[model samples]
Target: MDFKDYYVGLGVSPDADEKTIKKAYQKLAKKYHPDVNPGDKVAEEKFKEATEAYQAISDPEKRRKYDELRQDYQHWQKRGGRGDYNWDRWQTNPGRGGSGSQGHTMSPEDFAEMFGGAGRTGGFGGFGGEGYSDFFSTLFGGGGGQGRGFSGGSTVGRGRAGQDTEVDVQVSLEETFNGTTRLIRTGEKQIEAKIPKGVRTGSKVRLTGQGGPGIAGGPGGNLYLNITVSPHVHFVREGDDLRAKQPLDFYQAIFGGEVSVRTFDGEVLLKIPPRSQSGKKFRLKGKGMPNIERPDQRGDLFIELSIILPDDLSEQELSTLQELANKRG
Candidate 1:
């Protein structure tokens, strides 16, 4: 197999950090994901190539080996020599037969981060054949007979499970209180997603078999919806509870009356006691956001009364207020 430049394939520098490499791969995966480009051979190949590059470098151990080999390849080329000698040397080296259990191997962390727990769900992870390249297998250990991947699975370079993906989804505050449905566009598919009630920011809605297409027809990965609840026009969220301001007229505060209060359910009449002060807080039991884990439970809504005085009070109204103050004194 020809030596592949994994860094060039993913458009990342050799010295890029794990976070940067992951970010670069995410963009490529989204663009060339097989699900997004069904039946397109070119796209499929590109997707596979990107996946290959990510696996090679996203892992520190694997990346270190690749980097070292890449330098050797570059240096060899500079000496007016092709990569044939490098390949021939490692392929014939008997000491290269370690099965990649130690140096230049894929780690559990690498598999989990890049392949969505590939270490736990081990499968083949190599180029067209030979599990990996001449350099990787030779340096890392594909040279062993009946070799097993570090993941404790069959030899690498076979079928691989698809990479998982995530999409940011925003919902209205009311939606969180009373569940909602959204038309989510993923890849080439438009999913009519029924968002459960009580999903807050950081909530994840997983869609099975919706991520990157499986390699060697293994299995499609999962897609996740990262929830972000939009701010409400009149309310702010606090845990499962909600808070809002309810405006009350000065007269209403002085002479107990019902005030219109907006809740997720609808507008309700909130009873105001006589002599209610501005900024007074009232709890409307079980009227807040729903508890995601506990379907049977809901939070309370707190309303702070804000007294609104007429901008231009009539003489009669001013005189009545003065008389009320005098009586109170």
Candidate 2:
């Protein structure tokens, strides 16, 4: 088989962080997964390439050796030699094997050396080798030369990470305006979590080491909290700005007057300009949701004017309006 540059295929730098490598792997895996693109040879090849890359980089020890080999190759090229230097000598020499770096092929002793001494045990339950055993063990959980460990009536159990749980909490707009903390119940455990001020729908707060119990003494996973903002009777949110509809009389719309308006925190008297029309909006700066990271900064609030007309009109009131219209004409 040809040497594959798995790192380049995954679009990650050699020194990329684990998080970056995982993110890149996830993206490429989703795009080129064989199950997602069945019968597509190109996608199959890409998927194989990405999986190998992820396996190499995700293992810290393997990644380090790969980096050393890469540096050595670069140095060899600089010394006026072809980049394709023979690694057979390096493979045979002890201590120079560089972690027994095999190029996709191995002999019986190589298998025993790479895996434990279990490979020579009657060809791993007559299944041929450790390579086949490890592959099937990872996939079907069987064939480790020990019939007791197989998935079907096997003694060795399959290890896996626990499932993650999600919860939603509702907070008032006012609470969101200044940020608040609350206690939540998950299963029998009660956790105290601080809800950031600007938290919106689908915003997730992660609590590490608080998920399901780990198997075989491994570390627990994590808990993700999705936030839901409760709608206020008078206030609404529009992006980073808060919105409200204030009811006003005809006089307030025609001739400006000071009116009391409700905000997330408290009531504030807003000055309405003369000749204000319906749907006129007033802005209050730094009055919306507080910044989750920075408590000092905040968004804005917008108030829209809504005119209310009297449903009942007496005869005198109608006649007065008619007289005023006649005088104006």
Candidate 3:
């Protein structure tokens, strides 16, 4: 296997501090997490690869040792070293008699005992089909180890929290106005999550201990429900505010009359001024969507008037309208 550069993969310097390494890993993990990009095989692989790099680089001892190995490998290449690499030297607990790249037979029971049957044969936990590279697994406590594997089929020590996961959920405009609940499925369990009122696109609802399984009896991770408000036929959301077109008869607009407009808070009356034109805008305070953060607050609603002409006009009425139009011109 080609030598994997943990620093290059994570876009960090070889001498990067622990906090910097962790921050970089978290950024990548959030972007390509399996729960966030479900069914995306490429993202899944990237997540795994990043996790492997973090495992190797996050620990000070591991990073120091890995740095030495990297320097040695670079020097060896400068000395005309071929593709052959000594992986056993970097193997975790080399004195434990692990055959690095030499191939060792592991019965199904033995594999299960070592990795808790997290991944398929020749793989790690949770992920299937050759998860971690043999190189990483050998150097780290990943595959083919007497260790406990976490999600993504990576083996780590006990007491590690499960991975937090996120799933996208689109709610109707009405649902955003009024608080709503949805039954979300994560793995084999179904959970009903309540989305608070006034939630818009990019809103997030969190459920603790609902994510990936923890490692070796560790606590489970949290689950995040990301909100996306669906489009409505008549309403467009801007923050907590709403914009909509309200229809009014031409006569009411021209003659000045009160018109009832539909709003999330039900029908609201608006008096039209004489000679009102189409696209006349009006604001109705406290008639828009509720604020998710502050339940007592609501946004204003803006209504743009859309004039409707009579389709069934008598001949005399048509002639009168034509005369009015000519006079205006």
Candidate 4:
């Protein structure tokens, strides 16, 4: 079997840290994800390759075992002057007389079973069981082997951690102002999610021990809730700041007066400057959204004034306006 270089596949060095490996995997997976490239066999294959590589190297124990196997293969290659060697017999623990665990020498039938007849639900990388290569299975057990920490019913090594899950939660602008509680339905279980004040779009809240059940009594996974803030009809958000449009009568805009302004807190009197025109903006400090990190602090609210002119004046009023215009002229 050909030697599989997992580090090279992930475009990372052998000593790369776990965070680097995860970032590289996420990048590659996003680019070649089967969901992103439907019906593209090449892309699908690449995704599987990256997933397989990540699975092999992400775990410290698995990576250590794989590194040992890889070193031995490289030594053999150096000694043999470049030629194919029998990889089927290269199990970590070989049985006496080539007869131990059937895993030592996976048969064609076993390989087919591992792939699950090319179905997409239960296989390597959970990509519908396309099956890992014979070389991979030979060194680190099959897809269901101790490698990748998925052993089905067969117990091999220590306990396996649970899988993380993500879900989307939408909140209104008002809900974000004062914080709110939401009920999340996962399968038959219902969970109440507490959203703190100042959470905006793309905010992530992680709930520990709420993911997939662990294997072999390991700790459960975590649940990540992604916040999606809905659009507001009256106001728009820019970071912690808020922007809104307020209407003003022609008399108030021209002569300057106190105007009632509506904010998240309550109605406040805003001083309108004399000769204020349409599109004039006013700042109200500490009247906008709260800061996520420091809830005590807040941002300023900007209100753009829109001047509206009165219409359908009575004859007497029109005459008075004309007399005033005459005097001004």
Candidate 5:
């Protein structure tokens, strides 16, 4: 039956404004909300505590009155009068109507009826004012005549939205190029998720109403899938562009010809210019990864030429190469 400090409960200073009090209440409410911590009695208690604190400090008049009470209680304690103050009013009297008994035994229904029309639906964000504590009831004249409504149970409904869920989805680079559908397992069901073309690593997709189930008829939440793209065997991604090395024979580098180039889509014929040296680069437009948002648009693919010599040379080939070198000298 100690004095409840609304400011300390709400994690705000004595001079905190209404907005600051409201912010603190909202943060604590969300953390300890029954829906987020299902079947957890500790969280439920914390939620109620936060709700009560918010109710007392959110209103200017109530805050002023509570501050006055707090100051008086503190002054009494400083003067060593804490033992003399009547703490019996804070406790509930079990008897129906004792002659000199203090405090009243209040039921949940009676408690609800007392503050039924007091506009207990606003101020704090959607946490509701249904399960207020007896301490709160006593301060606002809803203390059930004499004894405060000290019932152990609350009268609030458990109507709260479900929590949002996040899951990681791994996709290959090829799958990103050609958008594919994947069967993702969530909870007790498997959902077919469509991976859009051009989805890169760290991309996120949201599915509506696919998160944890709500409580007491509240709306369900959303599910977010974080994309993790695997590395390609022969290609590397740079932003929206793709890079790869294409090997060409020494003859092709000396005497131009059509060489086959491998791309995500398929193989394409690339024309090699005459006298093309080793390490030459070529840009193939519109052949890279697609834009995530703009699937129709694609980036360019860069190809670096790697010239390779014949592993073994015949006697006639060596004689011809020597004659060519002599002519050049």
Candidate 6:
């Protein structure tokens, strides 16, 4: 798959804000949804493309990664560096239309280091240390130490790599809480994805080199899985914490006792203190979702108390209540 220009795909500018991105996505999604364009393969493909593009750029982390990759690719082209330069042959082979001894081969890394490390920090080319830079130059040829003649004389054939693909996967709150695996159908293939414990909504899972097929046997692109967690019936997610209301009877609120509470794992017993207030909350440490990237860390769970009252009371109960009130008076 050729890499889709996300901004272009969404018909927005590179500097578009979150609101603009969302608006574009919603408008495009509604118009191009598969259901709306039934049996129209072209429309369906467009819809899928738009959806994938939106999914990639809408996320902060994924956007950052995409930006880096794009910058690297652009720089690669701008440098006029052919992907398939043979440094060994270049070093041994003389420059065309010049003295045979004048030609020298430089590795890609060396070429980058010599050309100011490819103009960006920590990227394929700019500013790597002397040792690394020299190593690459020796391997690929065309580094800063060599003149521009090396690239001009060589006629190396470079293969274009495949473009990346993005997909959005929505998971239920229960699946997120307990960690589950699902099979996703894309185009004609089914991919099995494992939802790791502690992944939050909007987290992305990267399947390296699984996107579009490579051109001329080069490495294929990557597949990005954007996750969306569905809302739970009883639980609300706050960061890693899970929050829910636990209803209690008036008597239970006034006189403490053991009450059953629901958790992501299962039902658990929670003790209510005597004279506990209706708005009181309890925290269950390490009960919330796991951190998506950090498996060892877990979030906390909070339970808010709600007091319920009976609609009617027996005559004996009413008499007992009256007597208690009289004694208090």
The CA lDDT of each predicted structure is: 0.70, 0.61, 0.73, 0.71, 0.69, 0.62
lDDT of 1 at 193: 78
Model 1 Cα lDDT, one tens digit per residue, 1-329 = 56789889989887888888888987886676545576777875676567657777877877777787788778667645622543422222233444324323344465366555342321233323334434445555544334443223433344344777888889888788888888878778787777888999988876766777766654566678899999878999999888998888878998999988988788888999999999999999999888876656899999999999878898998899899899999
Candidate 4 per-residue lDDT, tens place, 304-323, comes to 99998878678998899899
For model 5, what is the alpha-carbon lDDT of residue 200? 85
Q: Give each model's clash number.
A: 4, 1, 4, 2, 2, 18
Assess every candidate by TM-score: 0.52, 0.51, 0.52, 0.53, 0.52, 0.56
Sort order, lDDT high to low: 3, 4, 1, 5, 6, 2
How displaced is residue 288 in candidate 6, in Å? 1.0
Clashes of 3: 4
- Residue 205 local lDDT, model 3: 75
What is the lDDT for 82 in model 3? Answer: 50
Instruction: Provide the clash count, candidate 6.
Output: 18
Please give the lDDT score for candidate 3. Answer: 0.73
Angstrom error at residue 242, model 1: 0.4
- On lDDT, who's better, 4 or 5? 4
Model 3 TM-score relative to the real fold: 0.52
lDDT of 3 at 233: 98
Error of 5 at 144 (Å): 33
Q: What lDDT score goes with residue 78 in model 2?
A: 65
> Candidate 6's error at 240, in angstroms?
0.6
Record all residue pairs in model 5 with backbone atoms less than 3 Å apart, i.e. clashing: 103-147, 104-147
Error of 4 at 272 (Å): 1.3
Off by over 4 Å in 6: 1-155, 323-329
lDDT of 1: 0.70
Error of 2 at 69 (Å): 26
Q: In terms of TM-score, which candidate is strongest? A: 6
